[model samples]
Target chain A: MKSAVIVFPGSNCDRDAQVALRQITGQEPAMVWHTESDLPKVDLVVLPGGFSYGDYLRCGAMASHSNVMKAVKDHAEQGGLLLGICNGFQILVESHLLPGAMLTNKKLKFISRNVHLKVENRDTPFSKSITGETIRIPIANHDGCYFADDATLDQLEQNGQVVFRYCDETGAVNDNANVNGSLRNIAGICNDRKNVLGMMPHPERAVDTYHGGTDGAELFKSMVEALA
Target chain B: MKARVHITLKNGVLDPQGKAVHNALKSLGFEGVDDVRQGKYIELQLEDSLPEDQAEEKVKQMCEKLLANTVIENFDIEIA
Candidate 1:
């Protein structure tokens, strides 16, 4: 159940992930900086959200080329579980650990609010504990809209790689609930091996009662139980 | 030598920022604008004394590797 959270220069959510991991897993996770060329052995590696490299060139472009991404990619290649939340998701895609890319929000505005996500699949280690339900998590970003080609999208859907989809509180996927205008309401997806997951929502920001929700706690617990 | 790279979203990809600009142009009374797509232009100064063809190829390699994300972007390289 050991985990490490990657902290880039502009990552604002590293501590949030750290606190959430510690509170949920009952162990202090390592805070790995982006410059480190290697990672200590850990069960999971998290890419937290923030304006890495001040979102220059692209949201996760500069951070993806950082020294630590090599280790992160190696970790995923070894079947180690990797999770990228928000900007972390951007980094994963930029690193090609996951498919697709992010684009500006459909309305050209930064959105910060809680949105319901339907659990599309629970077969992976990250969501094994989650039963069929809609969970609320906070999303805050300007470039959260996910885009991929039609063929790739079809494959993702057919292979069950889509793990999460934006949905209404009633557990129905609809345009009204797709605040970011992501294609097909896709909020998150896993790699072909299902060892890597990238999502725009901030589960770490919703893991405590003080945060007004604990829906994200089960995800961390699921990973720990599956790995440990 | 200088390598200029232009990265643009591929066809069929949505461009919200471009759409916003298009709408703004319409509001500003600009007509005959069929469409708009936003992109990035990067200029790189090479330190090597290579031929234009070789340097262009090198910049193209750079574009494929880092300058552009081939998934949703198309990069055009110009050498000067």
Candidate 2:
């Protein structure tokens, strides 16, 4: 499947997403800068992680209104696949592509480590190929706490929009395993349409064996299969 | 005209930084502190030609659009 990765000014993971996509899709994904008003026609659009706009005016607030976001919104509206990782997830929430907001991590510190995530809703296009119920991914950020009102959380749960949740190695979600204090241990969520996904963990970063294990490779493979 | 905006997290939203500050204050032996919440104060300069009412309105709009994240924050604007 063809894809394009959005590159904001401070995006440090654009190349990671590109590398993962190239490995999975067998072609280079276009790197679209935030200043550009349009996106290349592709099956999937990715907003990779980084402190866009230097995290000013809230984490993703400024980058949410960047020039290229108009097209990203358009792409989501067209039912095209869209994925946001880490700070990209922050931008999606700031953009209202997904519900909830990110706050400072509960401990008031940045968390950088490997965390186990249960595939809460694998029926979506992003996780359809994962043959297992859990995956290990790396999360690195200070403001990764997910927050939303009770009503919104309930709605998302009822609609099956929550795609991943922090869990133990045995796939048990418990309060202690909640890395960033996201409500209900949420690690990733998709919009009601299921085409847009915003996740805190960097699946791209986990796609290479050299980094660790290739547990994240299935997510990329899932998207390719769904898009195909 | 100059406008100042106070952006604060909304009620019921967890403020980890504020909690941390509160802990620090308590650690420093300030027992009288009831509760502490932290927020941001942003100042913007407006054109001199703009009327006071218009400037306040514009700043309010700015708060709604960008200065404040309405989902998690509340903003108060004052123009001078």
Candidate 3:
């Protein structure tokens, strides 16, 4: 399946994501610059991780207004699959493609570490492979905390839109599940119909055993298989 | 014309930066500081005297599009 990864000024993870996609899909993904104002025809669009605009005015505030984001928003509305990881997630939150907002880590410190994530749903195109089971991916970032109003949080949970829950090595959820102390320990979420996904963790960074594990490889492979 | 956009986190939203500032203020021996909510000060110089309605609309669009994330922060505009 053809995929495209959006590149903004400060996007450091675009290449990492592209490499992961190439390894899994056996094809080089298109690299779309943020200023292009359009997305190439593809099965998936990825907003890779990075400190866009140097994270100057808040994580994604500046990058969200780029010319290409308008097109990205339009593509998502037309049922195109979109994945926003780390700062990409921040862009999605800022663009209103995903609900909730990202806040600085509760400790106000930058956190970089491998995190365990329990897959909550396997029905969507993004998670259809691996039998919809739990997987562990390294989450490395600051400003990864997620927040939303009580009503919004409740609606997300009630609708089964919460896609992944943080977990410990033992596969348990608790404060450890509360990455960055996000309320409800939400690590990743999807839109109402489950097309767009925004999460703080860097799955692309964990796609190889050299990096730690190959669990994340399936995330890209699943999308290719789904699209095919 | 010059305009300043005040972008602040909405009430009930956790402001880690504000909390740090408040702690620092307390450490500095300042009292009577009920609370501290850190916000942004954006100064924009437009090319022309944008009408009130037009400016308001542009500012709002700016906030929604860039200045603020409606999920966590709210913005107010002032044209000068």
Candidate 4:
């Protein structure tokens, strides 16, 4: 499937996302800069993780207002696929493409490690190909804690928009398994339409067996198949 | 003209940074510190010729649109 990855100033993970997408799709995805007002025709738009704009003025706040975000919003409104990982997730929230906001980790420290994630909902394009119930992915961020007001959280739950939640190795969700103090242990969520996904885990970091496990590759494969 | 805006997390929202600072203060033997809440202070220089009311309105709009994320934070603006 055709894809594109948006690059902003201080986007350190853009190249890593590009390499992962190229390996999976067997074609180089377009690298759209933050200043561009338009994006090339593509099936999916991936926002990679990084401290965009140096994480100044809140994470993703500045990048959300970049010129390229207009096109990104349009793409999502049109129901084209969009996946935002880590800091990319923060951008989606800041852009209002998704609900809720990210807060500093409850422990007030940056967390970088491999954690277990439960596939809470598999109906969305981002997680449709998963054959297993849970997966292990690397999560690396300081402001990864997910938070939303009570009414919004209720709405997300009622709409089945929560796609992933932190869990133990055996796939049991508990407070101890929640590395970050995310509300309800949310690790990923989709927009109401299920076309846009935002998550804090770094799936690209685990897309290859050489990296450790190939669980992350399954997510990419699922998206490619769903588009096809 | 100049304006100063203070942006702070809304009440009931978790403030880990503020809590950490409160802990540090208690460790330093500061007494009667019932609570500690962190916020941002931003100063802006505006057109001097603009009327006071207009400048205040503009700064309010700026805070609503960009300076403060109303979803989790609230902002107060002061003009001088």
* Number of colliding residue pairs in each model: 0, 0, 0, 0
What is the per-residue lDDT of model 4 for residues B1-80, given as tens digits with 9 covering 90 to 100?
A: 88999999999889999999999999999989999999999999999999999999999998987888899999999999
Please, what are the lDDT tens digits per residue for candidate 1 over residues A85-186?
Answer: 999999989988899999999998999999999999898888898755888989999999999999999999999999999999999999999999999999
Top DockQ model: 2
Candidate 3: tens digits of C-alpha lDDT, residues A106-159 = 888888887888788777777878553567888777898899999999999888
**Pairs in steric clash, model 4:** none
lDDT of 4 by residue, A8-44 (tens): 9999889989999999999999999999999999999
DockQ of each: 0.83, 0.90, 0.76, 0.81
In model 1, pairs of residues that clash are: none
Q: Could you tell me which 10 consecutive residues in candidate 3 chain A have the lowest summed lDDT?
A: A125-134
Q: Which regions of candidate 1 are displaced past 4 Å?
A: none
Give candidate 3's error at residue A94 in angstroms: 1.1
Docking class of 4: high
Judged by DockQ relative to the true structure, which candidate is superior, 3 or 4? 4
Candidate 3 C-alpha lDDT tens digits along B1-69: 777899899999998889999999999999999899998889988758568779878878988867777
Residue runs of model 3 more than 4 Å from their true location after superposition: A131-133, B46-58
